[model samples]
Target: MKKLLLDLCSKLEGRGIHEIIDRLKLYYRYLITVLFYKPFIGEMGKKTVIYSPIRFTGLKFIYLGAKVTIFDGARIEVVDRYGNQRFSPCLKIGEGTSINQNCHITCAEEIVIGMNVLITANVTITDIIHPYDDINVPISRQPLITKKVYIGDETCIYQNAVILPGAKIGKHCIIGANSVVNIQVPDYSVVVGNPARIVRQYNQMLQSWEKIYQ
Candidate 1:
């Protein structure tokens, strides 16, 4: 199959056949994805494209809005049960949100990502935290603490950023690469650092992003 594709590509080098082939492949993949996952997903809107090789758990607890694109190698897990505890978890991805490759979203309670949010590669968003308060029990066996996470509309979370439990990122915010956000982020702000802090904020009157002195 590889040899045949290579030979075909060589033969059709300059005839714009490559683009046609690519589109066909994409359409085929989309069809396959919908057929395989649609039955299990609780609510999946039209034209939501989920690429191949995704690790999904509790599909019935996940809701995807229209035109949401989840790239390859993404892991979306909704944990409904942990030991004897049970949760009614919901993971909602709003319309036009694009979650890039290798992104991991784990929700035990609720995680709501608003419309047009851009989550770049390798980002991790989770609403559950593992507690190690007990020395007698293993950390993994301990009860989990969960909080609701919210990423507002038009927010951009860059590569390798971690949105931890109870994070409330406001609309049009920019979460910088490699940042760890665990608290509330005001609207139209640029945050960056280990424990992410606002470095700039959009001045509506001036229509510009001004550096925050603090």
Candidate 2:
């Protein structure tokens, strides 16, 4: 009996037990969202479901809209630029948006996520960039640069994508996996690749996407 129990324990130790515990914890998500998360946020609209075990900070500057669902392991922070509470509305997520697991979003200035946006797992969205121009000062000690990142309504950002500072993604746009977006994306466009470029754009007159080559 002892050997049998030890063997079972050894098998369960290999990721299976951890996954079971995580699944079990999901049942209490609503309770955790209301009791632990709601009060600290800048704004939280109705019926917002946030999966637990999320790493959250600077909640006073973060706003989440109605029916927004944030999955497990998301790290979200609204950092004060100077470590002072001078900035208001650092992050804003619009209604009906779903943010998948393990996404990291840190904002010092402003990050506006518009309505009905879908952000896949492991995406990184940041409005602040570390300054490294000065040779004398360490990069970590240098002052950071802040810009606004705007993701428009109905946009879909795929897994492992990075939305850098000053990116303005328009409505109905699709950002492909592992892409880096640093510029403005037009409405109804499909953007892909590193330093993401618009590969296809919808033509209203033709009612179809026109392939773009450059």
Candidate 3:
């Protein structure tokens, strides 16, 4: 009970103050934009979500998970002339993880990503594949591709990683930066390079079949 009280007091004192400070910063940003760029807004009452000082255009659709943050220059494009992107709603992110700046995650099918999944800069997650049977038709006119991609809990994906359609990555897997995965990766494995190969398999002292290197 004493620990709980201490925790509550900490939240009330420190966390509350930090939130107030963040809001102050946001308010200052709004004030500067209003004063300098008043001609652009034309008397819009007030801005709720703040935009970047630089013109980094990409946050448009479906951001879930209240703790989610898209960094400076990070791109999350979910719509186009083809149709209202049916992709943003297809992506799900778990708790305590971050997708860094310049990452592009495009989905046409469901993508269930697990908790503590660290996705670094320039990581691309796509579930669509286009048909190349006919060159006469535009790429946009190609067939809608679908294959669900599931990344298990505690997985770490590095910069420039490309997770293609239908790839099921298991828990605690470490995918090296700039790796291109086109197949399923087993749990607790380390994969690297294009069409990634497993360089290491996790050891289990219990001698379980599920833990052995495949």
Candidate 4:
């Protein structure tokens, strides 16, 4: 019996039983978070998993679609009132979209992210901009200027990219790593650099991506 027990233990160790236990714990945590937040969220679709250690504000204004997964350390906020300003904000994250760790998304008016979008780690998507028109008042205390931000279907935003107010990213577009996008990006284009500009665009007639030289 002792030899049989030792053999079973050896097999379990080789199978990485510890790793399986850790994964089970993580899934349990995710289940608890979903059950707690589902009642408060404006709309929580089926199979939407929100990982633990997330920072959320105005949960009632945020809507998440089916199979949307938000990883750990994400800060998602919908500001209905800030610094003497009142807003009716709506933040909608579409089906199958996955937001990676440490992404910050804040909206004061409207921000819509379309289906199957992949936002990598450390991305910031915001629709409110702090106005510093008055030099006498600090920027933190100033009123926010908000515009609608839209990201179309199947777009991929890479790590550390910032999507600012009034930016519209079209379908199947790619926003490169560490890029800052504050303008409109047409469909099937790849944008890179600060104040992101389209570096490559798909030409339907040629059935290929053509490089655009600045």
Best by TM-score: 1
RMSD (CA, Å), each prediction? 5.2, 8.5, 8.9, 6.1
lDDT of 2 by residue, 1-214 (tens): 4764465456557567678576445535755777788998888997688985367889888889998999989999777755433555479999999999999998889999999999999999998888899999888777778889999999999999999999999999999999999999999999999989999999999999999996
Cα lDDT of model 3 by residue, 1-214, tens digit: 4764465456557466678677566555555545654444212233422234233222332334433334445554433223533443356666655677777776556677787788888898877777677899887777666788899989999999999988999999999999999788888888888878788777677543332344
Residues 53-164 of candidate 1 have per-residue lDDT tens digits of: 4788999999999988888899998999999989999999999999999999999999999999999999999999999999999999999999999999999999999999
The ten-residue window of minimal lDDT in model 3 covers 41-50
Q: What is the lDDT of residue 213 in candidate 4?
A: 93
TM-score of each: 0.91, 0.84, 0.66, 0.88
Kindly list the per-residue Cα lDDT of model 4 for residues 1-214, writing each as its tens digit: 4764465456557456687576556556557657798989999898788885478999999999998988899999899999789999999999999999999999999999999999999999999999999999999999899989999999999999999999999999999999999999999999999979999999999999999997
Native-to-model Cα distance after best TM-score fit, residue 161 in candidate 2, in Å: 0.5
Q: For residue 139, give model 2's deviation from the true position in Å.
A: 0.8
Model 2 scores what on Cα lDDT?
Answer: 0.87
TM-score, structure 4 vs. true: 0.88
Name model 4 segments beyond 4 Å from true: 1-19
Model 1 residue 8 CA deviation (Å) reads: 21
For model 2, the stretches where C-alpha displacement exceeds 4 angstroms are: 1-27, 81-86
